[model samples]
Target: MFSRLWPVMRKEFIHIRRDPRTLVVMFIAPLMQLILLGYAATTDVRDVPLAVFDQDRTSASRDLVEAFVASGQFAVAHYTGSDRELAALIDGGRARAGLIIPPGYAADVQGRRGAQVVFVLDGSDPSIAGSSLSAARLIGQAKSVSIQTERRGATAPLLEVRTRVWYNPDMASAVFMIPGLIGLVLQLQATLLTSSAIVRERERGTIEQLIITPIRSFELILGKILPYALVALLITLEVLILGTFWFGVPIKGDVGLLLAISCLFLLSTLSIGLLISTVANTQQEAFLLTFLTLLPSVFLSGFIYPVAAMPAALQFISGIIPLTYYLIVVRGIVIKGVDASTLLPQIGALALFGAILIVAATARFRKRLD
Candidate 1:
């Protein structure tokens, strides 16, 4: 059985070795993605360019402006004289945030009347907006406290919630982002490359040749898939090693177990690609179908979004996405230091999904070839 599959697998490997594009996709692509996305896919937004429109033009207002700058979250990029200028700065992408300090703002704080600061934010990206807004609120509260100290010589009532974070104590977005990147990068490239595998053959009139052979459908499917599957696994391992040692991400769980589960993850994604190849007569169609499947998988897979936070309908949709379970399992093992026993449910789900995908892809592949 293994002997029969080797020829197909070898053919695929030879294609990779001979094709510069395949070599890049198989090896260089993932590393390049890691380097690029490691920088891009971060939630920690800082030094947000800010434009201040201080209508008050008072010492107190200046103090307020200084507070935001002191927080280091906002960098005062432009000081606008008017609301229109402030709006223009933001609209023109020169500023990510704008602050409006209304005239008489100092009197409200000194007189013990609650003063409000108007914050204008670019609502285009929620992450940037949310972080900047929260920082702004903190600055306002701090200023309010300072005013109270000067007026009454006492601090405001504070209910400090003592929070201790475990596992990822630093709360680095890289730590969170990188592990999820493992899944995102792997599922996408692995699926995409294989999605075009058979379709490329069809485009080149090779599938007709394949049909003339005595090889079983499963043998053909395994031949086409196993090479890519192994390649995907190696890529995953390479990323894991690079991410671990180079980036200092500790893999607290068993590396062997992680790899084992990752194989299942690859099996599913690769099969999805293989299934796409079956119906797609051209490489472009195969690529489109793969991306059509990939985009939703990324969104619903809980890589960037919390599954619990999604609406009931979207969350329900995420249930069948294999990456959802894989992410949970991988994150649990790598970050939380959970073992295989703790992740049986996810393991089972991934296995089930992989099995189903393999069977479906195989059936379609055989049908198409026949």
Candidate 2:
């Protein structure tokens, strides 16, 4: 078994070495994507362009505008004289939020009456709109508290809320996303590389040679998977180093545990590729099928969106995707630094997925070879 497997593994390594493009896609592409997406995929909304229409022209209104700017969440990009101009700014996408201070704002504050200020938010992008709305509300609440305190001649407010964020104190999206990105990159490279493996052999008319040989189906399947599994592990290590050193995402858990779970993840992904190989007659079909699997995995696996937020049907579907379980494990170990006992459920799920996929892939590949 070892002798037969060694030849296939060595051949795969030779093929990878000769193919520069494969090497780039496996290594360089994921690194570039990690850097680009790390910055682009942030949820922290800062410096949101704000358009202000101050009808009061009073110190109170100016102070309100200054407060928004000082919070570092909003920047006054346009100071409009009329509502039309403010609306135009938001319509043109120059401002994500608009603040309109009514003429009686100062009088309302001085007389201890409720001041009504209209905050118009561009609702085109829900995420940005939601964040801007929250910031605006917090700023408004703080300003209201300041007014009440000044009127009471007090040094401190009556009520103060202190929030303590755990695990990710800074609330940096990269800290939350980098671990998931590592899983995504691993799945993509492993599946794509192995998905095309058997198809490539068939396309080149080399599969017939293997069919005529004495290599058993399970040995051939293991042979084809092992090399790419090693490659996937190397890719995992590369991205982990980049995610930690370059993105400053700390790994607080046991490194050995992370790698062990990663190998289990690779098993499922490689098996998925082998399964694709048996079904797809051409490399293009394999690529397409791989992408079809990857899209749902990325979107529904709690990578970018929460799986709990998905509808019950989609949520049930996500349960079957190996990436979903792997992500829970990866984020648990990498971000929360939880031990194996804490993540036993996810570990068991990954182990089950690997077992099922590998067995199914072996059966399919064997049937195809016969």
Pull out the clashing pairs in model 2.
none
> What TM-score does each of the candidates earn?
0.58, 0.60
In angstroms, the error of model 1 at 327 is 0.5
What overall lDDT, based on C-alpha atoms, would model 1 receive against the true structure? Answer: 0.73
Candidate 1 per-residue lDDT, tens place, 141-230, comes to 676776776787544422111122345655556666667788888888888888787888887888888788888778887788788888
Candidate 2: lDDT over CA atoms?
0.77
Query: What are the lDDT figures for the candidates, one per model?
Result: 0.73, 0.77
What tens digits encode model 2's per-residue C-alpha lDDT throughout 236-342? 78878999999998898888899999999998999999989887777876786787678778776778865534556666878898998888778767776768876
The per-candidate count of clashes, in order, stands at 0, 0
